[model samples]
Target chain A: MICNFGAGPCILPQEVFKQASQAVLNFNDTGLSILEISHRAPEFEAVVDETIKLVKELLNVPEGYSVLLLQGGASTQFSMVPMNLLAEGQSAAYLDSGAWASKALKEAKLFGEVKVVASSKESNYTFIPKDYEIPADAAYFHYTSNNTIFGTELFETPKTSVPVVCDMSSDIFSREINVSDFGIIYAGAQKNMGPAGVTLVIIKDELLGKSGRKLPSMLDYKIHADNKSLYNTPPVFSIYVSMLNLQWLKSKGGVAAIEQENIAKAAALYEEIDRNPLFKSPCAVEDRSRMNICFVMENKELEKPFLKLAEERGMVGIKGHRSVGGFRASIYNALPITAIHSLIDVMQEFAETVK
Target chain B: MICNFGAGPCILPQEVFKQASQAVLNFNDTGLSILEISHRAPEFEAVVDETIKLVKELLNVPEGYSVLLLQGGASTQFSMVPMNLLAEGQSAAYLDSGAWASKALKEAKLFGEVKVVASSKESNYTFIPKDYEIPADAAYFHYTSNNTIFGTELFETPKTSVPVVCDMSSDIFSREINVSDFGIIYAGAQKNMGPAGVTLVIIKDELLGKSGRKLPSMLDYKIHADNKSLYNTPPVFSIYVSMLNLQWLKSKGGVAAIEQENIAKAAALYEEIDRNPLFKSPCAVEDRSRMNICFVMENKELEKPFLKLAEERGMVGIKGHRSVGGFRASIYNALPITAIHSLIDVMQEFAETVK
Candidate 1:
């Protein structure tokens, strides 16, 4: 079987896919396809409720925070964050470390003043900016926990007096964190969770209803929280798959256990990149993402041949982002450690042939 | 197998569900689940493009119109319609026929002045208002083509000097329409199309970029259309299922053929509701929807026993909306004629027993 390493919409556990496939045809022996069932049905209600419970339990989300399954992905959340939190004259501090971070800052500027605290754009976003001063007067401090395009990740949560909001689209659930530190943490479920439809939003209940501007029902977090994410017809199938994925994660000993495996997987590939004379790592070692391990060949001409060889060897989606053209092996949670070793073996075989 | 009739996330073709279930495991023999594939990948791009093409071809959408598969369902479109079309101080006329229309109006009021020219709330929204005057100076005239909660439908497109915008969430694709007559037609793809999560928006290209107010990236229709709904990571699974459903629709001779079957199915149930002395239909005969058929028994006590009888016989989701307080059998495109016949048989048997 080919190994998939595409960034978002990356990979999921095989067992989860089996259960999800079965659910699509016959959900819980109700003799109805999950695709055809009503969102208001008790079966779907149980799915939503159980998903929220598992997410909270896995992340250790405190009592004051509410877990929500929303649509429109993290891209929509960029605008929603400022729309629901920043008032007319207010400003929100943002860290522009990568492509997604810059995009979020751009969207936030449309709603209100966006105070960019720091940026690594001059270095083509190969590293994360550190020791940035977050404005206490701002509505909130916004940051992306992982930079998918540039293969950089913020290992620690930013310390700020103002409420901290995060777009943890890639790295969420791959590692354990203190959920109480942030006002809101939103992640698109494409990576490490389930599929490319639902978004997981964990918000501190007190942080809601603070934006004075009138908001649409769908855009307002309070309405969703109040109704318990049932204010409208949710993405039922996506949520069901997410619940299944979370169940699988729990069965494999939750986030803490997964984090250890992720570290080992990353270390193996990074070691090969450092040792192999034909390849080099572009991202700063300190901020290198465990999820997306990016590398480049010493001779640029080898890139095309390397990709073809990898493809022929049953490797897929190893092509890097267009802006940073080389290779990105996105080893998400479901990507077995053996897959990483297989990629390394390919890299070694290719290097020997070139030598 | 139980037949689903409650409203959207409603019934889909059995063939579509089978293909969808297989896709959840391996999409097109690519050794990857459709959920795990990238939106930018050829596999998913093909899915999105083919779905749009099928929609345009099936509906006979004119050249100047653009079709988009969007997230947040029709609820977000309630705000997006005004935010994209109505400028500050501008008024848009609305037909307040049912619960969803009122919710749309409530959201529109937040954007600008809403002139509700007609409403059927006085009669419990059991019939569509006729011959209502459309305000000539309004930005656009908005209405719901079918009310799922109240089981009423507009038989013809409302003629207006202002641009016509419709929420065809419940009854879209169940029948053919003059697509050129409306400036925009939006539907949540739960009823006749596919599943919950994605919304189908067919907008006249010229109607966009006129609101003058800054819009969030996700809420801006122009951006989505220009990007071909690839502006962000879309609800990939929902769109894929929608594509499969549309393919199924095409295989069964498109919307015109399905419309004929829909009429027959609705007639069979409605004929039983009218012929039986113990039963009655709440909606006006002329305005009654072919998609969602509502009925009530003379003795309210019979409602419980009839529903139990229907459920025991492998029928599901026939319970009426809580607001309407009776029974609703929503027969969307995928609901078979046999299911409707079974419902009719149940109705006749119940009438004989009670009489």
Candidate 2:
């Protein structure tokens, strides 16, 4: 089996994949493909309800938070969050650490004023900026929890008086966090949840209805929250797959258990990168992502040979982003520790050859 | 096997389901689920490219038109169409025959002036309004080609002076239409394409860049067309399934052949509805949709019994929309002729019992 490490639209549990595939063929033996069923049907409603329940149970979401299954990905959420929260003439604070954060901030600027509280662009986003002050009058403090491209993560949730809005697209459910600390937490399902169609938005109920702008029905968070994300047809198959994946997570003792596994996996790879003579990890040691582990060869020429070796050894999606040409092994929730061991073995062999 | 007749997220060909299910387990033996592959990867880029090509081929999309695979469903397009097309002080004309058209007009009003050219709501949307004049100075004339809820369709494309935009969500590929007639034709993929996560937008290339409004990148059609819908992570699995469905359509002799089959299925059901003494077709015969066949028992009390009978006979999703509830049998491009025959038989049996 190929060890796929492509960031976002990354790997899923084999059992979840199998169950999802079966549902596609014949959902619950109704002889109807999951693709053919209406979202309004009880079967689909059950999936949505169960998914929300499981999300709450797994995340230990406190009572006042609402979970919504939405579409258009986290990129759309970048615009939606600002459109729904930042009022006219008001500003929101953003902590920019990577490409996605920069994009979110840029989209937010179209809706209202934005204050860059902190950014790591000066260091090419190798670390999450620390020791920055959030604006006192800001509507919300927006931050990305993990940087997929730069392979850095904010280990500590920023302490802000303003409502905290986070784009946890790459690392949600891979670790445990206090849901009560944030006003809004959104994640595209492709990374840790399930697939690429639906986005999961968990927001505090009271934070909504504050944006006074005339918003479209689809863009309005209150409408979706009131209607329970059934305002329009949802991404049914995507939500169903996400539900299955969440069930798998629950079976594995939920997020706390998975977080431990993730920590171990990240530790194994990061340890290898630090020890291997021919390689080096570019991310700040303290802020290295447990989800996306990025490293590079000491010599630029060795990059091509190492990539080819990894590919030959059944490692897929190890190539890094085009802007930063090196390597990124994204070990999501579904990726096993054994896969990391296999990747390290390949890295060690390549180092020996280069030596 | 049960016959599915839900309006959208409706039935797909068994062959397409088999292929899609296999892809979900392992896409093309790549040892990775389609859900796991990056949107930019060649594997998924190929799916997007092929789906676009098939959409063009099936619809006979004319030159100077761009087809985009977008997320957020057609409801989002209701807002996006106005955001991108209707500028300041500009009024757009809308022909409101049913719920969806009225929704589009409602969203358009959020952006600029909207002139209701005509509406069939007085007759409870049982007929399409034909003799309305398109406002000469209107930015664009918008109408839904087929009303899924009301079971009405505009059989003839309206000739308008302004740019003509049509939401063909229900009847997109079920028949042939002249592509040159429309400035924009948008459809939710759930009904006639594959599933519920993606939307298909066909816009004239020249019509873009005239909105004069700064739009969010995700909400802007021009940006998506320019980026080939890869501006952000797309609903990869949804798009992939849609591609497989389009391929199934092509294998069944493209839209031309599928149109003939669709015609036969609708005719068989309509013929049965007319002859059966216990039932009546409520939609105007001239405007009655071939995609969604709406009929009801002459006696309202018989509705529940007939629905139960259909359900018992291994038929699913035969219940009509809650707004005009009796029964709605949605026979899209993928529904088999045999399924309709079984429905007719069921109707005949119900008539005998009532008589």
Candidate 3:
């Protein structure tokens, strides 16, 4: 079996794939492929309902928060987040820890004034910027909780008074998060969730409608929330697969349970990187992402051969991002710890071959 | 076997589903489920390229147009069409043909002054309004080519000097059209194209950038076109399935061949509706859609029993839209002509019982 580790649109549980593929053939013995079913069918409505309930149960979402299963990716959310929350001349503070964070702020600037509280761009986002104060006058505080490209994460919520909005595209559902602490939390359903078509947005209901902007119905979160994410024909198959994946997550004991496994997986790999003399992690120790582990070879010329070896040995999608070329093994909720050990074994084997 | 006549996210070819399920298990023998493959992967990029190529070939899309496979449904396009093409103080003409047409106009009004040249709203959109004047000074003319709910279709492009935009969601690939005649053509893939999740957008390269309005990157067609639909992560599986479905269509001959089948199917159903004492069509005969044949009972009380009999006799999704209150038989490209015969048989059987 190939170990899939390529960034977003990454691996899901094998069982989920089995179920998804089966649904494509025949969904729940309904005599119809899941692809051919209408979004408004009672069966599909149940899928949407169950998926939402699973999200609430897994995240420990509070009473006032609305969990939305939307389409487009986190990139679309970068635009929608500000469109619904910030109007012209109103300022929103941003923490530019990585490429995605900066992308979010850039879009925010087009809609409103953006205050850059802190950014690690100069260091190529090697660490998350921590020592910054959020302006009270800002409309909201926005940050990318985990930087997939930079391989760093902000484990704790930033201290802020303004409504906190996060783009947790890569690392959501890997650990426990207090749903009530933020005004909005959105993640593309590609890394830890399921595939690349849908986006999961958890919003604190009361904090909405204050932007007072005449938003297009699709861009207005209130409309989507009010319509229960059925404002239009949703991404039906993607949502269905997501529901299957989320069901797998719940069966594996939900977020709190997966957090333990993620921690162990990260620790094993990070320890291997530190111990193996030929390899080193470029990211700052404290901020290294639990989801994506980015590391580089001490002897840079050996990198291509290492990738080839990994691929030959049944390792798939271990190539690092384009911006930061090295190797990134994303040990998400579904990646087995045994695969982590296998990656370590490859590293040791590579070191031996080079030495 | 069950026939899927359910509106959007309706029927796709059985062969496409088998291939899709196989890809979900192992895509092109890559040992990775299509769902897990990165959008940036070379193989996935090839899928995107080939899908665009097929779309161009099937639609006879001329030069100076970009075909983008993106996410969200036609609802997202309802916003993006106005956001990218319309600016404040500028006026755009709209033909309010149906509910979706009005929804598109609603979004356009938020972006600019929308001049609805004509509407049949007073008659519940039972017919496509004609004899409306096109405002030459308007920036563009927008209309929904097919009304899935009201069972009307504008087969001919509206005679307009201004650039034309169309939402061809329900009947996009069912028939042939001159792609060069419009400034933009978009469709949610759930109908004739593939499944829900991805949208097919064909944009005239020159008509963009005239809006002179700042658009969020996701809303900007140029950005998506320039990036070749890789501005961000696309709906990988949806696009893959679309490519598969399009290949199946090509195998059976292109849209022109399907159009012949569609015409035959619609003609059969409409002929029966007119001849039967129990049933009659509510839509204007001139404006009747080749897709989604809508009919109602002459005796209002027989409606429930007729629908129940149709369902019992394996005629699924014949219940009309909520707004129209009748029976609709959506015979999209994938729906076989034999299914049409089966439905006619059911109608005849039900008629005999009622008499």
Best by DockQ: 1
Q: Report lDDT (Cα) of residue A335, candidate 2.
A: 96
Q: Candidate 2 chain A: minimum summed lDDT over ten consecutive residues — where?
A: A316-325
Please give, for residues A221-300, the per-residue lDDT of candidate 2 as tens digits. Answer: 99899999999999999999999999999999999999999999999999999999888999899999999988987899
**Pairs in steric clash, model 2:** none
List ranges where model 2 is wrong by over 4 Å: none
The digit string of per-residue lDDT tens for model 1 on A61-112 reads 9899989999999999998899899989999999999998998999999988
lDDT of residue B339 for candidate 1 = 92
lDDT of 3 by residue, B191-226 (tens): 888988999999999966668888888888889988
TM-score of each: 0.99, 0.99, 0.99
What is candidate 2's CAPRI-style docking category based on DockQ? high
Whole-model Cα lDDT of every candidate shown, in order: 0.92, 0.92, 0.90
lDDT of 2 by residue, B1-355 (tens): 5888989889988898899899988898787888888888898899999999999999999889999999988899999998988889999999999999999999999999999999999999999998889989999999999999989988788987789999999999999999999999999999889888999999999888668999889999889999998999999998998999999899899999988998899999999999988888999999999999899878999999999999999888889888788999999988889999999989988788877
Write out the backbone clash pairs for model 3: none
lDDT (Cα) of model 3: 0.90
Going through the candidates in order, what is the number of backbone clashes in each? 0, 0, 0
